[model samples]
Target: MFYFDATYVLLIPAILLSFWAQAKISSAFNNYSEVRSINGYTGADAARKLLDANGLYDVPIEVIPGKLTDHYDPANRVLRLSEEVYYGSSVASIGVAAHETGHAFQHKQHYVPLEIRNSIVPAVNLSSNASWILFFIGMIFSIPFLARIGVVLFAAVVVFHLITLPVEFNASSRALKLLESRGILYGDEVKGARKVLSAAALTYVAAALMAISQLIRLIIISRDRD
Candidate 1:
């Protein structure tokens, strides 16, 4: 039977941090969503401007459904922004738009970390889904070999999460600098943009922590089965 003990105890901090990060991002996004940019540029406009500034005129921007679902698809060379971020002229919208643009910039410049992250996308996706299934199966059957395999697979997920940190941080950093340098946000408006980006960054940090903690628990459980 599965029981909670020291293995679970080690995960408490990461779990708490994940909750806090979620709350922080939600609050920051909501707050900044209401604060309009001084220049009255919609999120799409901001993204286009950034892309044009970077000489990526062919990169198309599309409006997609869902909240906070903005992303840059390097494969398709397109930027997909959610409704709020696609049409809204608020500081939060612009910040989110710019952050995705940063990814495009990274792709254009061949940012090593982003390249590495993208290269492992397939492996990460496969492992992330399979790891839990393998782990639970091993737990149910008390199979040490299966559990070890599960742990190894899950370790890839942890590595993906860790590598994701630099990619995300660099994107946010690029967004902030581009926003200020390009005169998209002025004075205190930059601070608002920074706050939004910073809060979003915390979510990535939380994810890394949670993944690491889970991996540790898995390692402990695998050892105990021996």
Candidate 2:
């Protein structure tokens, strides 16, 4: 019965694209992770140098355990890097660290898009968790109103994904520029960082596309039940 649903068919392209994006990022990261930067700067060193250069001395860097789990927490004014990123001196490590540092820069500059994304995080979290439950209950009980409500809630997630595109792109752009301007990466070294960042950017694009496709699929499914 589930396999016969037209909505599932509509989502196939998105599923494929998501898989491709994930593979691209993983490959790019793996390849660059083996190539060390000329300056021998670890991810933690790169983050600190970038932050200090930008006059953000107070923002501290912390090591966390995970692969590619690096992030900047605006609330705590801290940058958290994974084990490899925090200790390794590879191009991939510095690139990922710089990207997170870019987020800290955005927070310091009061970037409008980042602020907007942060503002809706709580609502987005709630809606994302509730959307599936509401949709399944509505479908099982044949309640169009509840199903519509679920669709509307899910729309918030799509909106969040859309807003996230600019935020992510700007961060990568900042990372590349700063890495070069600050003389952290030289000549052909920057190319490897660019590849890693570019691959990461594609993942965001794929995510946005996937969210839009799913939203459209839900709309189609709701209309058919009517």
Candidate 3:
């Protein structure tokens, strides 16, 4: 009863907070994208400079299509960026490029968290899609036992997201330190980089919070049936 009451009471504020966080992060990203960099280097160029500086000269930086689709693939040893981020000569671009490169740097040095995340990839992929569907199906059938089992499976998705928070935060931290120590960006550029990374971090935080809420909601619904 206490759990249900707590979960129900918190749902409204949680949903509203999620919306607010998303909007804030999106706005910060947009603002950073509009601000120019000191070196006049494009996101792709900054990425190249960082990679080359670190002797990762062979890692290709490509401009892929879409928004915020940037990532580094250790399997192919490529850093992919969206058109806006890859070509734009803005603080946001540099921040994103540096962040993704941080991932590559991590992969190169065999970071344990990234390694753990990579290991869970296959299972996470399956569970991400299947868990919610199974949980909903069980609820529709009025089977609390089945729903509870579905929730157990769904918990893996939450765990993956929780683990991801640290990986992302660490990447951002590395990116900021690299930019600051190497003097890659000047003036308000460092602040802008911090803004971008901090905003991105919030998205991960929001996702984890959402997962927690979903998990709580499922538990409440199952208990009601008992």
Task: TM-score for candidate 2, please give it.
Answer: 0.97
Model 1 poorest 10 in a row by lDDT: 1-10
lDDT of 3 by residue, 1-226 (tens): 3233555664676677778777877898899888888778888888888888788989999889988899999889999999998999999988998999899888888898899888998998898777777777777777666778778877887888898998999998988888777777886898888888888888888888888888888777777766
lDDT string for model 2 (18-125, tens) is 898899999999999999999999999999999999999999999998899999999899999999999989999999999999999999999999999999999999
lDDT of candidate model 2 versus the reference: 0.91
* Per-residue lDDT over 84-176 for candidate 1, one digit per residue giving the tens place of the 0 to 100 score: 999999999999999999999999999999999999999999998888888878888988777788899999999999999999999999999
As a TM-score, model 1 comes out at: 0.96
Clashing pairs in 1: none
Q: In candidate 2, how many Å is residue 219 off?
A: 0.7
The prediction achieving the highest TM-score against the true structure is 2
Runs of candidate 2 with Cα error greater than 4 angstroms are 1-4
Report how far residue 129 has shifted in candidate 3, in Å: 2.6
For candidate 3, the clash count comes to: 0
RMSD (Cα, Å) of model 1: 1.2
